[model samples]
Target: MVRPDGSIRVGTATVAGVLAGTVLAGCGTVGGSPAGKETSSTREQDTKAVRSAYGKTAEQDTARVTLRVQTSADGTSMTASGRGTVDLRDGDSVMTLSAQGGRVEQRVVDQVLYQKLPRSEVPGGKPWIRIDLQKAAERRAVGGQSVNDPVQAAAFARAIDGKDVTREGTSEVGEVNTTHYRVAVDVAELPDGATLRRQLGPTLPMDVWLDGDGRIRRQQIDMTLKAPAEDAATDRASSPPRPAKVRTVMEFSDFGTDVEAKAPPPRQVTDLTGTALERGQTQN
Candidate 1:
């Protein structure tokens, strides 16, 4: 099947739209001052200029995001890559995640998400699964699970809110020369669903890039995990805590443009509410 974005669906899953791997949940204000040399804009003023650009980008009608993510810790490593679009006005989105041999895609509308899992993850041979975000939030999947949704898109810039930010000069993103900013995010300040307690614990490192129009151009988020200290009662504090790093990169383009995404065919879609909802809860 050909999706509105002009991508063909493979297998039973309907194909559409497409990520760095991280769906935005919480974004904030910035900290610090401009780096490099003195210029026409004061360091503090440059920081605000950078923040202003992101502020405007967040208010656009849509964002086309390409993403790559790599996570490593505890001697294991995992990598995920995808592409997707977010409707800034409504939090609706479509994404195609990586799967063996083919791609598993999903669409979000009216707080309901319709998705096609990898064939290996399909239940009872069903090609598509529908999930209600309102319900999913009840099950502890609140933060990042809703990244594809617009609510997070609106809130993403909040990551730099009230924090010190510094200009890192200019860098090219998606071939566009962008002004770069370095930001530090306290775990407590992150948006509700984008908290790093489970990933980074204390703080998360982040980067933001903006183009001339003050729109977001790219982002980099660094998260690290540490293995828990062994139980003193059970045995010696051996193994201490092994640290792992996760890198997430997101590039944005096509701001304010309409995304070509539509609902999958009805026959191919299944609801995740009721008993089906219980059987397929996306979280615990």
Candidate 2:
């Protein structure tokens, strides 16, 4: 699927022209604040607890993800969705993404991402394309961010705690009662890769729900930004391009669940070797 940033990665290569587009830190230390404190009594304490809790993801690895995005550029708007399960610990995920008039299956296993294309350009109608993320990362490929390293749960605390935080109230997400907080996600404040910030551009609004365990139950981000690239659909004309507004909600469930990914059957797979791998990579 097109990443929210309006790019797609088939392996290490960017399929920007392929999809209409494409498609967090923990708490801990905050602004010269003490390095490691996990408390939740006061608002500051609560933020620290959250930042810490977010840091503790090793015990919770697998989760189901439902993602939706609407991108407008080039006088056209594209809506896409991905419903899948991911192994956060290993960064392995299998998903079916719907867009561009059809559906394609994508699986990331062992730092290798494989896609079964909607139309096979390979000989014998091979349906799969492979990209090695390890190799791609050195080149800064589209999916380079797929590194599945364990992140400090509360790492975001350093970025968000100092901002004005408002705990709106308590809400029930599923069976869990959660404390809801609304804050602006400042990209400049973040130390890690600003993936969302880069996608939404500038600062964006964020709403988060944290369970008693200080684990994130849900998060929502909404923002509008000039499209990340020249509108893929735009012709030669250069009238003011359309701005794309995106809203994303992530609800995590079944934490620590079992998640396993495997390659497509060999018969159904196609290795995008040599020139085929060099072709179709669109740079925006």
Candidate 3:
């Protein structure tokens, strides 16, 4: 679909756009101190434990994910859902997203994104559009935020272990027992956090649930955003922002699951790398 810049970005960039848009939906408020006070040493221990668990989870290499995103802007609201599996190491992934009564499937392999669209919407009647993320990067057409990297998305929980991470006790998520935590995600550490921080703020509140093994079971972010201006080519300075609110939740399962991704048959593909770059479209 077309971005605010009037350019198309399919696959991970599209998902990233929606997700990044979700997180950037609004500025964050100062977090209230957690209910229980902790000694500095205890906080350090908890943070270390959480970070270690995230590291262990990342080493698992793959997982299945289900997500929901809801956004409200200009007095209008919408919701979208997605299901996918991703290779945490290679960044290969396959995902399907549903929104407004439509579904779209996407696959990423060898740093290329393949999107399946209605035949009428694609050139040459090809049902799939191929965009080379590597080519896009080479042309500086992507913001290098790792937003399109499934690996990055999977490791997003790592942002929760900042100094302020608070253990909120234990709870059940699905059939698993998990420890609940709350923190202001450290945007500075995220690959694209600097940009997000500039657009939204330095931190965003997040709630996470971790299984005993330290793997994330569920995570949520609720934010209010100053929506970027609609002019496709205008910079933030030239366009007034819109007020909006967004919330996103994601759950993980089947860690280390096998995730397969293959490039679409060339005959059914329309390469859009050149056109996307020519339009000066950049994804964050």
Question: For each candidate, what TM-score against the reference?
Answer: 0.69, 0.66, 0.75
Q: What is the C-alpha lDDT of each candidate?
A: 0.54, 0.51, 0.61
Query: Which candidate's TM-score is highest?
Result: 3
Tens digits of per-residue lDDT, candidate 2, 1-284, equal 44322323211111211221122222221222232342345557655555665555435777665444455655677776555666655567666677666676777777666776666334467777666644544343342132112232333455566344556667776566777776665655553346545655555566667788777666555557554454534733756566665554445567776656798777876554332334324432
For model 2, the superposed segments whose C-alpha errors exceed 4 Å read: 1-41, 119-124, 134-140, 143-157, 189-202, 227-238, 265-268, 271-284
Candidate closer to the true structure by TM-score (higher is better), 2 or 3:
3
Off by over 4 Å in 1: 1-41, 99-102, 142-163, 193-199, 226-244, 265-267, 272-284
- How far residue 177's Cα lies from its native spot in candidate 1, in Å, is 1.0
What overall lDDT, based on C-alpha atoms, would model 2 receive against the true structure?
A: 0.51
Candidate 1 worst ten-residue window by lDDT? 8-17
Residue pairs in candidate 3 whose N, alpha carbon or C atoms collide under 3 angstroms: 25-224, 25-225, 26-224, 26-225
User: What are the clash counts of all predictions, listed in order?
Assistant: 30, 23, 4
Order of quality (TM-score) = 3, 1, 2
User: In model 3, which regions exceed 4 Å deviation?
Assistant: 1-15, 18-34, 134-150, 153-162, 223-240, 278-284
Q: Where is model 2 poorest over a 10-residue stretch in terms of lDDT?
A: 12-21
